[model samples]
Target: MNIRITGTGSYIPEVITKNADFDNHEFLNPDGTGFPQDNKTIIEKFKAITGIEERRYLEENLNTSDMAILAAERALENSGIDPETLDYIIVAHNYGDIKHQSFQSDTVPSIATRVKHKLRIKNPKSVGYDILFGCPGWIEGLIQAQAFIKAGMAKKCLVIGAEALSRIVDKHDRDSMIFSDGAGAVVLEETEEDGGILSHESGTFAFNEAHYIHFAKSNKTEAPDDLRYIKMNGRKIYEFALIHVPSAMKTCLENSGKSITDLKKIFIHQANEKMDEAIVKRFYKLHKMEMPKNIMPMSIKELGNSSVATIPTLYDLVLHNKIDEQKLEKGDVVMFASVGAGMNVNAMVYQH
Candidate 1:
């Protein structure tokens, strides 16, 4: 009774937002103070730190659910699975269907329901729901799907991570440069495959870390408080992830009974380029091993941080050979890990 990922898909929006696009953004500090340096200097520093030169943005006519449906369609097609056979459809998202110029989220029906409807999945037993666990939502959804399969509750599940952060970003905030929009999905099924999901771990640190990433008023002094946007304490999140994410990944891998050297790839959340590298380095250090070259593949350079979409999207690209020099061969061991809002962290060990 192995729970395996049979197929993968992703929707990377066509709109490209380059770092230079922010040159005229009138960026400001959270406290409403102007930066001492010009936008050029700020953008340069941002690129150096985040390793993000550009990011994808959803077309104005589309919403998060639209992308999720697209990705889901591809995943089902890739798996050669029947939509009617799916027992669960889980959507991992933070912001729902926010219009291009609107800040309010429209989540009347869960994103999963919307995706199921759009996908034309008519099976009533195909339960649809949404989960909000920050950036780690997608991985958590995968874990949930695995649990259901393990418990004899479901045989197949569709897990999609989609977000339209561009629709909710505060253009006045410098951190907005770190966000974009995209969606990724996978088909998980009960199979007799030799390699599948091995083990997983998850945790929430809500006491003091609850507000590390939260909604807040615009950084502009005169902006209305009623209209809020995604905000975060970048320094706090960086420190927190560096200290905890590696530990969680190590635990998950160890639980899988695989040695650190058995790991061929690590699909960590595309948060910050530096933070991810440090986390993997620390993970190897925990086992007294040096980080291997090309063990980590990144999509943040072009996708930015699409919250829950990062890991699955990155995995889809690599598994499909869309990413140069990154490949996952049969029998190879891989790990998935993420950390974000909810102050949450999660990881999963899998075999290809």
Candidate 2:
């Protein structure tokens, strides 16, 4: 029996925030020191490096779970599967439901349970849960689904990655520009198809990299210390991903018995454009080959980094022809990889 992604869906927030929107904002360093350069110059530098000119923000009335539910509904509809038949619903998120202008994260009932409830899945057998593995959460959830299906614990699962980073980011920090809100989901189930998940890898390097990403006081020194927002050492993360992510992808692809020449596409975490390009370049280098043209699909240019939602959203877009000149054909071998908070990293090889 093969475990396959039967359907996929994504929710890209309607709010479009262009870089020009931040032209008048006060940007500050983590040390609370003001940059000598003007905001326009700073934003231009940011755009040059991250290749992000715009991103999406969730509406104030909706929460992370709402986005998950929307994506899940579309996934279910695409799969044409009865909700009652699902054996599991797993949601991956970092900050939970943060109401508009609210500083607190609400995760009491778990995002997965909230999504299941909102999706109106009434079957008691359909267990719901959430995993907080940073940006890699969705891919990890898919790996877990594969295990459950292979172990005979479940045959059908709904895995979702959603985030409302706009609700949790510190406006004063430059990193805030890299974050946006979005959600993506997939239905994984048993199938007799010839190809599905072939191999996967996961790792965590918390001994020294633990604090690479964490919540702390806003970059604005005058802000109350009692309230904190997402923070990260961007340089360290870029260097770390460059050295590690490519190797992980290589291992996953090799384990799948697929050659370097066989890879048709790669769905990498939409963290940064230069970093992603560098990582994929090194992966090809490892195999003693040059990186293939258009081997990777990127949504970060428009959607920004919506944490776990990146890969699935990109995949859904490509599969639906929403992205120009990017599509997956049957029997195409693709790789999914991500690295994020928890200082975590994961990769998976899949065949369509």
Candidate 3:
């Protein structure tokens, strides 16, 4: 059996946080000393590198599960698929539903289960679970959904990537500017058609795992704060993505029996605009081909990096022609790629 993406949807919170909003906030060093650069200069530097002008953050009352439910509802409606017919609901997230201000999280009742409850899905046979493969969680969920259908274990599946990353980010850390909150979802159905997910490649560089994002205790001697917040070695991750992501994309396209000329669009994780552009260029150069302009679409300038939700949300936007210059026609070959916290990288080839 082949698996096809029947529908796609996404939800971004109402609150828009612009890069200039950070101008008043002060960044502190581990020792409590203030950073030399002011917020204005910092924001400019971030824009120069990440190409992010603004991002959306969940409101005080919303959580990851809430966003997932909204996106999933839209996806199901778009697909005209009955909730009862869904064989699986896979929610990909890092920080589960965290209560506002409390920082309390509950994963016992998985985010997927919460989404299922919100959707009022009554079928006990329809399983709900979560995947935590870092930023590649959603793509991994899609890969698993395809496997289930191919094995006759499922017919239709809902894959969602939701992240309330704003809640987990340290307001004083510059990394806070890079993460936002949102959700994106897709409905996958078993199809006999020739178009669907064709091939995928995924791997982890465990050695570099320590260099990526992680939660750790504050090391400030004067502050002595106990709160754990998301921290990362930005330079190291940039290097890693520049080196490994291109190889992963190449391997995936080769495995799918396709080449750069066969691709319609490359939907990459909205991590950083400069890094993504470099990776795509290197990918084509490896094949001795010219870099195709307008082939790689990006939304980081407006959406920032919502972790796993980036690719799916961008995909949904492009699919609906919401993106100004991007278009996808039936039978188009699209590729998805991502790299993040797990020091993991993944690429998938899909036929639209």
Model 2: per-residue lDDT, tens digit, 1-352? Answer: 9999999999999999999999988889888999999999999999999999999999889999999999999999999999899999999999999999899899999999998888777899999999999999999999999999999999999999999999989999999999999999999999999999999999998998999999999989999989989999998999999888998998898899998898999999999999999999999999899999899999988999999999999999999999988988999999999999989999999999
* Candidate 2 lDDT: 0.94
User: lDDT of all the models against the reference?
Assistant: 0.94, 0.94, 0.90
Candidate 1 lDDT over residue span 1-352, tens digit each: 7889998999999999999999888999889999899999999999999999999999999999999999999999999999999999999999899988887899989999999999887789999999999999999999999999999999999999999999988999989999989999999999998989999999999999999999999999899879999999999999999999998998898899998889999999998898899999999989888899999999999889999999989999998998889998999999999999989999999998
The local lDDT score (0 to 100) that residue 170 gets in candidate 2 is: 92
User: TM-score for model 2?
Assistant: 0.99
Using Cα atoms with residue i matched to residue i, what is each candidate's TM-score against the true structure?
A: 0.99, 0.99, 0.97
Model 2 stretches astray by more than 4 angstroms: none
Per-residue error at 248 for model 3, in Å?
0.7
Name every residue pair that clashes in candidate 2.
none
Ranking by lDDT: 2, 1, 3
Candidate 3's TM-score reads 0.97
lDDT of 3 by residue, 128-226 (tens): 999998999999999999889989999999999999998877676777899988999999999888889999999988973655778865434444367
Better of 1 and 3 by lDDT: 1
Error (Å) of candidate 3 at residue 321 is 1.3
